[model samples]
Target: MNRLRANDWLFWGSVLACYLLQLMPLPQALLPLKPWWLALVLMYWILEAPDYVSLGRAFVLGLVGDVLAGELLGEQALRLCVACFILMRFRARLRFFPMWQQALAALALLANDRIVLFAIRAVSGEAAVPASYWLAPLTGMIAWPWVFLLLDDARARARVRES
Candidate 1:
């Protein structure tokens, strides 16, 4: 049987911070370029502790974002769920990949999330957002390594404490 790991309070703390950060007001000029902070945190936890947080958690967070952002209901939730599910399903292989490769995979996942959101908006006849909506994935891809390293360090510390 797998050994018991410590509770992931730090992980959840970071996740909460990410969500709060997402809700923070931004300058109108920079709003379009803001990265998907909540999505990034969800991806991090899904990769690090699939047992702790799963697609359902991601979906709920996305739903909260949808309500806060005033987007169509279930829009972000569906995308976040699909993204987390895919990440969890392939996590073992993903863990072995190099940092750059993993970031690339994350970028692809984020792109997929955007596509789903875009498709949903189109179906509902919402006005098309600017091309800048695509930039979030790229920025997220760049920021992922830092997030991974920081969270992984926390995981390592947690593991050591448990032992």
Candidate 2:
């Protein structure tokens, strides 16, 4: 019971941290390069603790993110739901892959996220995004290993403390 409680806090705390990171400001020149921090963190949780992170949870998180970022209300929610669905579908195989392989998978997932975002914007008749807008997923791919390791370490420490 204590372990479960610890895990819950760790999960939600990491998610909150990701939201902060996502909302943090960057120089205008670097804005397009900002990684999809929330997506990356949520992916870790979905893969590591499936029961704790579901499609509905992803949707809620994304909705919160959209409101926080001032994007279209359901944009992030839809993107997150799609990413969550894909991750959950392949969670079994992804869970056991080597970290390098997992990072590659992260790239694919993030790229798919970018595509979803593009489709959403296009349908909404938004202005064409600059080419640099696509760079975020690459940054996200590079950051995946570190994000995974950091969260994994934090989770381990949380369990150890409870033990």
Where does candidate 1 stray beyond 4 Å? 1-6, 161-163
**Clash count for each candidate, listed in order shown:** 0, 0
User: Tens digit of lDDT per residue, candidate 1, span 1-163?
Assistant: 1224344577668867787878788899877667787777777777766776766777787888888878789888888888888988888888789999989988998888889888888889985788888888898899889888988887787777767
Worst 10 residues of 2 by lDDT: 49-58
* Highest lDDT scorer: 2
Candidate 1 whole-model C-alpha lDDT, 0 to 1: 0.80
lDDT for position 97 in model 2: 95
Q: Candidate 2 at 64: error in angstroms?
A: 0.6
For each candidate in turn, the TM-score is 0.86, 0.96
Return the TM-score for candidate 2, rounded to 2 decimals: 0.96
